[model samples]
Target: MSTPWTPTEFEQRLRAAGNERYHHRHPFNVRMHDGLLSPEELRVWIANRFYYQRNIPAKDALIVAKLDTRELRRAWIRRIHDHDGHDGDEGGIERWLRLGEAAGLERSALESGEGVLAGVRLAVDGYVNFVRLATPLEAVASSLTEVFAPDLMERRTAAFEEHYGWIDREGLRYFQVRPPQGRRDSREALDLVRRWATTRADQDRVLAALDFKFDVLWSLLDVVEHACAQK
Candidate 1:
């Protein structure tokens, strides 16, 4: 049998995968962060991205079901609440809607999926389906993208604040709050994957799952970039 990797080695491999393939380096995101996108391009992006945002709770729900332990379930279920909200909490979906509003998108259109591109829907749905079919370890490992997300969120928030002043400041709440939340969530998922993915095959699967997530994210932007370029 192939030797299993130590947690440190495995983690390094995962981070390397992200560094190489994550959407942060995508031309669309690079343009966004550089404050070079036209308002129409940014609006198209925001609208399509909401398709991914709204599906997060659904994706997390699938992962939660695959989790075996009540403790794991309890911890993972919070992700659903974070996006879907409970009681009076506004939740991430609502926060994203507010972002759409600030960008001048009609709430009805955003809610109705009028702005969601075909490719974005396919990619987001594919992610949810992958989580449903994945082993718990792989499903959780796919979320290691969150390990990179806190910094991305911080930079995105700064980019918007510095470059896109027309967007209502209040609508930036999702970017502001997501950094710490991503850190906490990624820590839990990393611990689980490190503990559960003990075999070489399991580690390989974990890495593959993370790469699949990168493809999903990158493909979404690919579609958006093409669509925006046509406009």
Candidate 2:
């Protein structure tokens, strides 16, 4: 018979899965963070990634709706605000739009989502749907990709400044802002998962959820890289 998993083993497995499959290792991210992507490649990334930036709030809201406690709801709601902004004049989505504009994409094209690749749209939608349908604990685990985000964001910001001279600081605002925000959010989320996952079964589910999330992130980058390779 197969051996049952323990909480410690589950946690180790989760970390291993992230090490194996996180977007940090993806070719698209590697190229972008290493200052190797062309201006046209940067434009493609900004255009495709706009879909993900826009969907994050919706994903956060879905997770919020699944939570039973007001404290959890309140804590989670900040993510929506961080992405959507107050009065539509600030926040991550706006910063991403500025990046798109710097890449020469029209505002209409971004808002309409017409320029986004089909695979990118599917991957983003799959993530939101996974959060919507998953258990609250599983939903939180799915956000663990944020744990790796700070490093990726820092590298991306540095790469843009050093190699992509066409994109000024104003255009790379989203990358500059994401590291601290991602660290805070991911820490809170990891704490919640670690604290609440007391049972072996719960830990296994959390790990699986994290693995699924990594696949979602990896799939998005794979599609982007495939397209870039074709160009």
Candidate 3:
């Protein structure tokens, strides 16, 4: 029953959603990037985030499997490799583990995922299911969080290096490695979404999908902030 929309309008809406609700604006993220978080806080964040990191490759695989074109699949496969690595001692997952170790969390604790809050798991799973069921264009659009990631990464890296001396460059490898890859991956995905979303309805759906994805990211931070507040 809603009126139609233009692609520009859809893009504006997605940007507005990012401005309003993205984790970049979250106080936890601000405290984290600014190096104000205690060691315990960093450990909790690293542990909780392992759940999200583990699921990303699975979600990418699900999305890749849904693609009909080999070219698309080929591009999508990099995400899987980035997260899962060739032999498990490499890739983003391992880097995240190193981050956990740097934050003083045991390897067993991070891999166990026992510390993940219910809300965080639900938000991340919802994102995965949404991407799997949505159109490919919408799926790609949902990843527009990458558009904001590089800036966040830069700020976070500076904050850690300047304010938090507990972690050094080696300990922060996850943040160090992600921004460039995120920029490339996000640009490619955004281009694909923009090109394939030909109709107003499709464009609107893509924007909504991105908004939903932002909510997923925001919800993770919210859960963390709430847990911090409760303690």
Candidate 4:
């Protein structure tokens, strides 16, 4: 059997997996950051990405259900609240709809899934299903993508301001809000994995789960890029 790695070694490998494989480097995302996408292309991306955003709470709910401790569940419920918005606060989903509106998409169409591509739906739903079936550790590990997300959000916001000034400034609020939240949430999830994934096999499974998440994100962009290119 393979030997377990030290906590530091395991964390390093996890970070490397995200660094090398995350969708921030996907061709479509690179083009987005470089200001190469046309307005329609950007709208297509925004609309399709909404599908994934809408499902995040669903995915997190599945993971929360598998968490054994009351404390863990209490901590994890905040993710759902972030997207779904409890206590009269606006949630990320609403913020994203505002973004779609700022991009000149009709809010009605966005709410109705008007521009969501077939491939996008399948890929996003696949992610939710994977979490539904995954062990709590694997499900939580998959979310380690958030560990690197704050930087991506920062860069994306800068790119939008610098290149895509046509989009309204107000719609950029989601990006602004995510960085600190991503940092806090990612630290918690990573700590959980470090505590629970004590064996070599569990650590490897965690890596695999993280990779699966990367593929899901990359494939979403693949379909978006291909679909947009056809126009």
lDDT by residue for model 4 over 115-152, one digit each (tens)?
Answer: 79999999999999999998999999999999999999
Kindly list the per-residue Cα lDDT of model 1 for residues 1-231, writing each as its tens digit: 999999999999999998899899999999999899888999899999999998999889989888888998999999999999889888999999999999999999999999688999999999999999988888898899999989888989999999999999999999998998899999999899999998999999999999999999999999999999888
Model 2 ranges with Cα > 4 A deviation: 1-13, 87-89
Model 4, backbone clash pairs (residues 3+ apart or across chains), number:
0
RMSD of 2: 2.3
Candidate 3's TM-score reads 0.91
Spell out the clash pairs found in candidate 3. none
**Candidate topping lDDT:** 4
> Where does the lowest 10-residue lDDT sum fall in candidate 2?
1-10
List lDDT for all candidates, in order.
0.92, 0.85, 0.82, 0.94
What are the TM-scores, per candidate, against the unseen true structure?
Answer: 0.98, 0.92, 0.91, 0.98
Report the C-alpha lDDT of model 2 over 1-231, residue by residue, as the tens digit: 345465467556766777787888987888787888888787888888889889999999999998899998999999999898877449999899888888788888999998689999999999898998898899999998888788888888888888888776798889888899999998899888887887777887888888888888788888887888899
How accurate locally is residue 43 in candidate 3, as Cα lDDT from 0 to 100?
74
Question: Alpha carbon lDDT of residue 148, candidate 3?
Answer: 83
Deviation from native of the Cα of residue 149 in model 4, angstroms? 0.6
RMSD of each: 0.8, 2.3, 2.3, 0.8
Give the least accurate 10-residue stretch of model 3, judged by summed lDDT: 1-10
